[model samples]
Target: MADIRVLIVEDDPFIAMDIESAVADELGDKAELIVVGSVAEALRATASRLSCAFLDIDVIGGKTFDLAAALLQAGTPFAFVSGSSPSDVPKALRQARFLRKPFSTREIATFLLGAISPLKPRRSRNH
Candidate 1:
């Protein structure tokens, strides 16, 4: 596969590390992982090219919908990785893809794989 440039936005250190580990284990050096802990930074960083993004709903002081909107406008697909329920997500993002928290590496790996893969039927990855 070509280089998979992935962005991960999460405030929790442990959770961020888990995502990083999973991506690293799955893609090794083929993955370029960008991990940020806040929504503001994630938004600014989204201006660059990204293969995909893993965003948390609740970040430090802001929600991720703004960045989600930007990614959507730019055609960069992303997945919401949060413990929050789908109802808690903004209406505009209610239909966006998601990967629930307390997730296993396999789950993360699977989501990442699908996110960067060829187009398929659009649906949330609730697992």
Candidate 2:
């Protein structure tokens, strides 16, 4: 299988580490995880190909709405992992999945699994 590039945008170190660990455990060697603490860093990370992303609503630079929009435009799948209410996410981006704060590792794993599954066919096509 092709490497699954995963982007994680979160400001809290503990939460970021937790998500990273969960992703690592879930994807094992097939995933390339990039964890960033700010919207700027997250935006910069988007210069390359990403199979999927997990974003926190509030980051160092700002809310992730712009970054989310960019990812959507790029046809990359992403989900919001934030304590904020789902209503806080604009209606346009509401289609993306939302995982509330204090989420479990199981939740992260499930999201990753779902996100990467749809990309497998695309990866096969590319090869």
Candidate 3:
């Protein structure tokens, strides 16, 4: 439970890093955070072991819903960290927790930790 790995997908590098920094600050050394600027990178990262992911709904060259779908299909647990309004989120993933922009590190850490909690059950569901 201590080593919570999270991937953040955002088009803006600065914002992505900010979220990563926040996770580190809140979780200290226990947080393993990875930040990517596009859905492609996020998809690639998911091939490895991940506790959770904070995904943006819209990217410059990619769609967030597609990424969410891939995660969902793979049974990977995730949350949304977006500037978009709730109504803008895809119908399939509307149930996930959303973290608005300018969120604190503590908030990101808490979200990641909580999202990862369901992964254990996800493993069972897949099997």
Who wins the TM-score comparison?
A: 2
* Residue-level error in angstroms, candidate 1, position 58: 0.9
Tens digits of per-residue lDDT for model 1, 47-114: 77888899999998699998998888888878899999878887887667888888888878887888
Candidate 2 per-residue lDDT, tens place, 1-127, comes to 3368999999999999999999999777777889999988998999999999999999998999999999999989899999999999999999999999989999898988888897664555555
Sorted on lDDT, highest at the top, how do the candidates line up? 2, 1, 3
Q: Could you give candidate 3's per-residue lDDT for residues 1-127 as a string of tens digits?
A: 3456777888888888888787677667765777888877887888887777788888766777887877788767777777878888878888777888867777777876666665433445555
| Model 3 regions more than 4 Å off | 1-3, 117-127
Q: Clash pairs of candidate 1? A: none
Evaluated at residue 95, the lDDT of candidate 2 is: 95
Off by over 4 Å in 2: 120-127
Candidate 3: Cα lDDT at 23? 69
Off by over 4 Å in 1: 119-127
- Which one is best on lDDT? 2
Look at candidate 2 and tell me the lDDT of residue 81. Answer: 99
TM-score of 2: 0.90
TM-score of each: 0.86, 0.90, 0.77
